[model samples]
Target: MRVVIVGAGEVGSNIAASLADSHDVVVVDVDPDRVEELNYSLDVLAIHGDGAAIETLEEADAGSADLLIASTDHDETNLATCGTSKVLGDAFTIARVKHVGFLRTWERSSGAFGVDFMVCSNLLTAEDIVQIIGLPAAVDVEWFANGLVQMAEFEIGPESHLVGQTVQEADQFDLLTFAAILRNGDVELPRGDSTLDAGDRIVVIGPPERVYQFATTASPNDAATDTENVFVVGGGEIGFQTARLLQERGIKPRLIEEDPDRAREVAETLSDTLVFQFDATDTEALERENFGAADTVVAALDSDQENLLVSLLAKRLGVNQTIAVVETGEYRDVFEAVGVDVAVNPRVVTAEEITRITREETTEKLTFIEDDRAEVIEVEVDEKSALAGEMIRESIPRLPKGVVVGAIAREQELVSPRGDTVIEVGDHVVLFVDERVAEEVTSSV
Candidate 1:
């Protein structure tokens, strides 16, 4: 498929990299440097021009493209690009925006902005943060099989009981499967002989209950409990959405905004939330508010530097968990290394979501793990598929290495996959595939 991506920023570049291997990708940007860098680094066409302009679209041959994605940081530009693409070409359009109002408007009316699909980065990031907060100990979480199956990543600490145990020894959960392990920045499929180590990020999939039970074992700190005192910094869209969602889940989080008007606005909008008109980075304010007793502190400030500082301060002040919204992917590692518990990148999340949507139609869901080194994909077993009416032991061996059957959903019932389990037609099959052989796994399964 020939795909045209507007905006050569982090989201656009990452999407181009993901689609370049399997499809024809063309990227447009106003910065010549970005275009030059993309042209030199990726196997895609990079045009230096205004993406919303008709001449630029014509230069990129957008009329014959299979898909056009607008991912600029500006919501108006993205919407305009999609609208222009719709008017000039027959390509399916996707617009990436950060405003929830736009999503609501598009939902109320189909193709409101001439977009076949829309991705809201702020909402996606907030939802991700909410998921992490809901399931403690999990750095990342994804659902599949219509929410029947859950896949989560947990970092093993030195105190974990399974730190030195092999996969076979750690197989205590009856319904959970050890999907993959990330050690030393490499992704590995856990086998009977594979041993888990401290600092290893392990991916597991199973029913929600089973996964929650296993989470406690993986990280004892994630034991189920009520988060009574939650602190949220920033009253921006991401922070507001997060606080609102948490409130809906019975959590009354205190939000801090430096701007008085913004704080007042949020306080009025959120009845359950307590909004403070003060600088979150102020030590005196944090101390006065008893931030030390906070169960969780989420830094959703506008600037990455400020968020990093807030998270670091929260940790120093004895907050149990600190989550920071870092826009740059490179800073995620830096944030984690500097004591930030979880780093949420809105751009990366948006890019991954868009890529999943653009993948094969048969793919019901796709989630990246181990920093895109591996993936968990959900596909339905149809009559023509190779997995139909086959036992796990017989069919799994036929697939490439590093690909494992994680779970199965048959008629709304969750099934933990095993050697004797038979995969029948109409069942939803979840598979863990290494990035190196993702295409092969997708085609075969």
Candidate 2:
């Protein structure tokens, strides 16, 4: 597949890095340095020009592209690029935007911008935070098979019950499958003898309820089942969306914005939410609002520095959980070190979504878990596939290490895979794969 990506920024570069080995990836950007960097680092073609221009698309051979992705930071530019690509080529078009209005417009009228699919960075980031808020120990969560199965990553702290236990010993949850473990930047398949250690990140997949229960038990802190109060800083799209999503779940969150106009807009948009027009970073304002009583605080300011400050202040004010939206991936660790519970990177989330859409033709669903160190994928079994008509135990030997079949959907029924369970043709199979052998796992099944 030839994938032409517009804008060689974080999102574009990430998508290119992931797809370069498997497909023909071409990236376009206005900055010569960005193009040069991509050309030097990745095995893909990079074009230096305005991606929305026809000549730039033509130079990248857009007509031959299987998919054209517009991921520039500017919403208008991305929309224009996708629309122009549709007019210039037969490739399927995808646009990344920060505003939700574009998504609503596209949904109301198909082909409005010639965009077959749209990815909203703010909305995606907000949804991710909501998922994290629901699950206690999950740093990241993704769903597959129409939400029937969930894959979550949990960081093992020193106080965790499973810190020193072997994989078999920690197999107390009948519905949960320990997929893989990442320790000190290395990926390891969780075998019966493999012992979990403090600071290790474990990926687990199972029913939503079971996964939530396991996460609560594994977390270092006492996990709360219900969040009574949530304080959201920033009146930007991400913050507003997060508050709106929480409200939809019957959680009325208090939102603070420095700008009165934005605060008024948010108040008008969300009737159930409490809107405060004041500086969220102001210590006096935070104290006046009794912010310490909130169960969770979300920092979604425009600047990473501001978000970091908000998260740190929230922690200082005695908030139980702090979730910050960090635009750049490099700031994630820094934010976490300063006491942020979870740092959500919108760029990484958008890139992962685009990559999944690009691979939708081959896999039913694909989720990058554990900081892209592992993946959970859903695939349909065919007669030609290696696992077709084979028992789970027989096929286990054929698959590469660090891969496990978590569940199977047969004729609208969910089946918990066992050693004796046979994988029949036409059955939908869900598997957790280590990044090192993801390609091998994908090809085999």
The C-alpha TM-scores of every prediction are 0.97, 0.95
Off by over 4 Å in 2: 411-413
Please name the candidate that would achieve the greatest TM-score relative to the true structure. Answer: 1
Model 2 C-alpha lDDT versus the unseen true structure: 0.87
TM-score of 1: 0.97
Error of 1 at 137 (Å): 2.3
TM for candidate 2 is 0.95
RMSD of each: 1.4, 1.7
lDDT of each candidate versus the true structure: 0.90, 0.87
The CA-based lDDT of model 1 is what? 0.90
Tens-place lDDT per residue, model 1, 303-337, is: 99999999999989988778899988899999988
